[model samples]
Target: MKTYDAIVIGAGPGGYPCAIRLAQLKQKTLCIEKESPGGVCLNWGCIPSKALIGAAHLYHKAKDADSMGIRVGSVEVDPEKLQDWKEGIVKRLTGGVRGLLKGNGADLMMGSARITGPRQVEVTQADGTVETIEATKGIVIATGSNTIELPSFKFDGKQIIGAKEAVSLREIPKRLLVIGGGIIGLELGMVYQSFGSELTVVEALPDLLTGIDPECTKIVERRLLKRGATIHKNAKASGYERLADGSISVKIDQDGKQITANVDVVLVAIGMRPNSRELGLEQVGVKVDQRGFVPADKFCRTNVPSIYAVGDVSGVPMLAHKATKEGEIAAEVIAGHKAEKDWVAIPSAVFTDPEIATVGLSEAEAKEKGIEILVGKFPFSALGKAMAMNETEGFVKIIADKTTKQVLGVHMVGPEVSAMISEAALALEMAAFLEDVSLTVHPHPTLGEAFMEAAAHAMGSAIHILNR
Candidate 1:
């Protein structure tokens, strides 16, 4: 039997960070993982998909460089070579994650871990070896989530696939039928679309990219339409049939009308379900919600005092950064340090054709809550940097209290908004006012200027553009 101060399960973004922080706090810790160190976000979802998206963007740009007077003879995407490049990046990142865990003084073990008692865990190794480890301090669960697969459209890992398979495609399908219009679907769908797959997106919701600012969503929708992609909203994927010619006939029911779309591949990216079941959670008496999410307190503690849960298994807003933050908080609590999940806002980014990034509340959310809010808007088309880059298709919107001018939310869609939203997050976290941002000097000829300009526009003292 092996004993430690704490044992962290699932060495994903959340688990590894928790173990590292625990070790740094001078607590002997062990981190166990059944698969890769970086988990799904690094090995499959975020890193690999971003690599493909970058490749697709470059490929599309090279193919259409005639407008910029940079003509090319023939620009094509070699899928095999592209996959190799993506794999290399994944290999490096995963290796780095493992190195970080080891360097932080956390013992890394590759095995399947199960909680058998409040202070004991069972580890099953790959070579049919089982060992019992005792955690003297606490145990943290950060197992993350698994992709949701529809019962009617199970994955064959060939024609029918999930987001994991979608990112690792060696051959671009002639026509792609995406079942959901959420973040995962659109992000990966647009990647394939840019790679010359005729895209047909069928979202069950009334619109695409739900829960985001509708204005930002509309801009992305327009771009999707302009690029010759088909969209079907308020549509339900009833079923599908395999054709004789290596094609799939998808039946979508939209407003009681059955529309059939024939495509070479069907991607099911509805959403991810928390990987909460069958971990002996029931035997350990941890309260998992009906939706398979293990409920945890602000301190990341479960029903048991010695047990904690974090990351996707914890709750909604299951982002990688959010998971890492929770992991640190849990680690601190175990070390007798004062820590809690107290953050003003968490930002979300969508890697569509024109990226959408936002922090804090949306305008609709503020209005629905009956808060009197003032909005400031600045278009990328009006930005000098956007014009210089020739990528002006979205805007920056700042939401604030009409009376106090305290910043409430910031929403942006356009070039590199993912990197720009961090400033908004900092402003919100620091409780900065609209004037605090507007009065600050932003460097000229950069996308960041749009944030300052937007704040000024909200204050009704704009220099470049007219105030709304």
Candidate 2:
């Protein structure tokens, strides 16, 4: 048995960072991964999808170049070349992650790891050989999550596909049916739409991006509609019939009426579930919830003192950044350092045409909690930079506590707002008052000013817009 101070199972964003931090603290660390070092985000989901989105964005821009006084005849997209480029990016990133693990003095073992016992791990190699690893101190579980598959529509890895398969699709479908209208659906929908596919989004929720601000989603819905994507909200998919030609007829019920639509491909982006199965958690003292999520305390410590869980296995807001932060905190706590996982903001970004970013509580969430709040908004249409760039599509909204005037949430939907959302997240994390954000001078002729302006509007001191 190989002994170590700390053993991290699943070298995902969460596990890797935890292992690295543990190594930095002068502890012997070992990280075991069934797949690649960088996890799903690096290998398939996040990075590859974003790369495709970038290519689609460039294609759309080139197609619209004629309107910008540049005469561009016909634009073309080569999915083969795009796939090659995306693969290159993925290889480089995963390679970098592998280097970091080695440099940090963490043992990178390629295999599936399970909690055989408290402070004990069993790694099953690809060759069907099992090796036992014992950690003297603790173990961190960051196995992450997998795409949810519905009963009626099982992913065959071909016709019925998930985000992973859709990323590298060679031929664009003439008609595509996206099963969910969440972040992944809309993002992939945009990509296919850019590739000249007639895309239709069918969501069971009343609105797209069910948890986000309704007003913000409205703008995206409008843009998607304008771009030729049909949305059917409050719709439930009944079943699908596969034709001899490989096309599918999808039966959907929207408020009692059964509507059938035919499409060349169906992409399921409903949601993801925790990958806590087969990790031998039950064999140990660690308790897993009904949905297969390992519950952990604030510092990511599981019921078992020597075992901890992070990322998707720990549940909600299954984002890479969240996992990374949790990994750091878990390591710090293990190293005898003062660390707390409590934070006011963990930002969520949607990579649609007009990207959506939200941090902290929305107006509805505040109202549901019976907290008195005030909201302010700044339209991108009024921003000089937005107009100049011809990318005016959405707005910035700020929600604050009515009593303390503390900024509660910042939601934005516009071009590249994903990059600008970190500012809002940082402010909310620091418990910054509205006045602090408003007083911070944001440079003129930029999208960032919209955030500051929104904060100013909350205080009724915005100079850009007249008093409403």
Candidate 3:
């Protein structure tokens, strides 16, 4: 049996970072992966999707540049060329991951791994050769998650599909019907919508992007509606049928009424389920929750001290950055350093049109907790930068404590709000008061000035906008 100090499974955003950090800590670390390095986030979920989104955004902007005084004869989209460019990016990033692991002194193993004992792992290589390895220190499980496929609408990888197929479509569908209205569904749906596909969204909840600020969601929803897309809220897609002409007829149940939508493709982006099964975790006495997530404490330790779990397999939020942070913390803990999952807040960004990003508590959440709060808002419509870009559609909102004037949350939905959110995250992490941000000088004619303005509005001293 081969022995090592630590073994990390699944070379994803979580696992690769943990392995690299452990090796840097001078531990004999081995990272095992059954698929290509960088996992789904780089290959399918995050990177590729963003590539498509960026391309679609550029195309959309070009088509509507007449108002900007830019006149072009014609515009066209070459799906094959776009896909080739996206694949090139994926190839470079995944290759870099491989090089980084080797450079960081982490052993890379290509195989499917299963824990056979408290410290023993059995790896089955591609050639059917099995090797048993022992981790003298610990084993970190970061298998991540997989897209949930509905039984009623199995993936054909053509007509009906999940996010993986959605991002790789060579030819844009003429009409697209999205089954869910969550982050994945809306983001991808809007991408295709920008490509001139007739888009229809079916959401089971009362509103789109549930759990997010409703005002922010409304702007995105309004944009879709203005673009000739159909949105059905409080609805469910029961099943789908394949027509003779190679089209999909989706059956939906909305408010006790049955309706049918015929389209070229149907995307079911309901959610992702943790990849926690068939890894021999049950046999080794590691507890997996009912939802298939591995529960870990502050130190990322499982109930069994020799085992640890991180990333999508560990819990909610299921974000890549969150997983990376947890991976580093776990590595530090295993390396004899004191580290825990201690953070004030995790910021979330939705890449929908006029992107929505939020950090810390929302106004509704604060009120639900019986906490008195003060709210401030500044619209992009009033900002010079947004007017210059001709993409003014959303606003920035700040929520703070009424008594202490401490900043509780910052939410934004506007142009490049995704990039502007890091400042809000830092403010929350440092427990900054509303005045802390309001008093700070921000450069003129920038989208970020909205944050400072919103903070001032919350404190009843806004310059650009009137206080409520």
Candidate 4:
């Protein structure tokens, strides 16, 4: 009968951070994991997929070497080799996560944990052995989510696959059908499309990257089309059937028109739901929503005083950063410290051919909320770096309150905007004003200057482009 000051379930981004912070606070913290430490983000979701995306980007650059004054012969991509590289990165990161937990003095238990009582948990080890542990202080559940699948088009892990399998596909199918236009679908589609696969994306939303700026999407969609990828918006995947030759016939309903496409593989990236059920939450009187999410307060505390839930198991906007933030807040609360969760900006990044990054409220959201705002935009075409790199296909736009001059949102669709969004997120978190950003001198010949320029535009003090 082992006892600890606090117990953290799941070893994903959120859970591991919570456990480490708790242990650092000198609390006897125990972390239980059913699988690897890095969870989906490192193992299957963000890391590995980004590796593949990087490889794909390199391949695209290589294909365009002629325009770059380089005479390179035709090159072909080996999906298996790419998979090996992606796997190596995953292994390295996962090892780092494990070391971080162990170094922080957090006891790591490799098993599945389930709540049996308010302060008790049962663990099922790999060898079918069961053990019970008691937590004197509190418990945190951070188990992440899995890919959502339609009942009709179930994943077989071969032909029909989730984002996990799609990341490590052994072969790049000749023709790939991606069902869903969400982040996962486009990221993976870009990977395969670069590897010589005829790619088609079917999204149920009327516009790709729903709720994003239509102008930004126009640039990305144009680029995708030029790269030989077909996009079908306002489309729903009905069903699929296997052919005699092992190919799949995918049926899609696009704006009430039925169309069939044949492909070697189909990826379902619709969305993800919380992984909160069957954890014996009912035994401990933990309440879960109909969608299997454990409702939590701003500090990640559930209805029960001593119980907390973080990560995908909590609800929407199930981002790894969000989970980690919640984890830190919960750990501090459990350590008897006064802490609060306050985030004015949570940036969203889409790693398509031309990346899309946004922080704070979108223009549509601001308008819907009845907030009077001034929008400013600076196209990458006017950027020196974008012209030099020949990647001038997007813009950076900033939205600010007209009266207060407070920056409300920052959106970008261009090269490496993902890395540039940290400034926007930090600025919003610190309650930055339009004048604050506009007067902040940005370095010349950088993409970030676009943000400063947009800020200037928002204030009607634009040096470049006509004064509105």
For model 1, give the 10-residue run with minimal summed lDDT: 276-285
lDDT of each: 0.93, 0.91, 0.94, 0.90
Write out the backbone clash pairs for model 2.
none
Candidate 1 local lDDT, 201-251, one digit each (tens): 999999899999999999999989999999999998889999999899999
Candidate number of the best lDDT = 3
Can you write out model 2's per-residue Cα lDDT over 1-468, one digit (the tens) per residue? 889999999888999999999999999999999999899999888999999998999899889888788878888888888899999999999999999999999999998887889988999999999999999888999999999999999999877999989998988889999999999999998999998999999999889988888998999899889988888999988899988887899999999899998999999999998999889889897999998899999989999998999998898889999999999999988888999788877999999988999999999999999999988899998899998888988999999999999988999999899999999999988999899999999988789999989988988999887645
User: For residues 239-287, what per-residue lDDT tens digits would candidate 3 score against the true structure?
Assistant: 9888999888899999999999999999999999999988999999999
Clash pairs (backbone) in predicted model 3: none
Candidate 2: 10-residue stretch with minimal lDDT: 459-468
Better of 1 and 4 by lDDT: 1
Q: What residue runs in model 4 are displaced by over 4 Å at the alpha carbon?
A: none
TM for every model, in the order presented, reads 0.99, 0.98, 0.99, 0.98
Clashes by residue pair, model 4: none
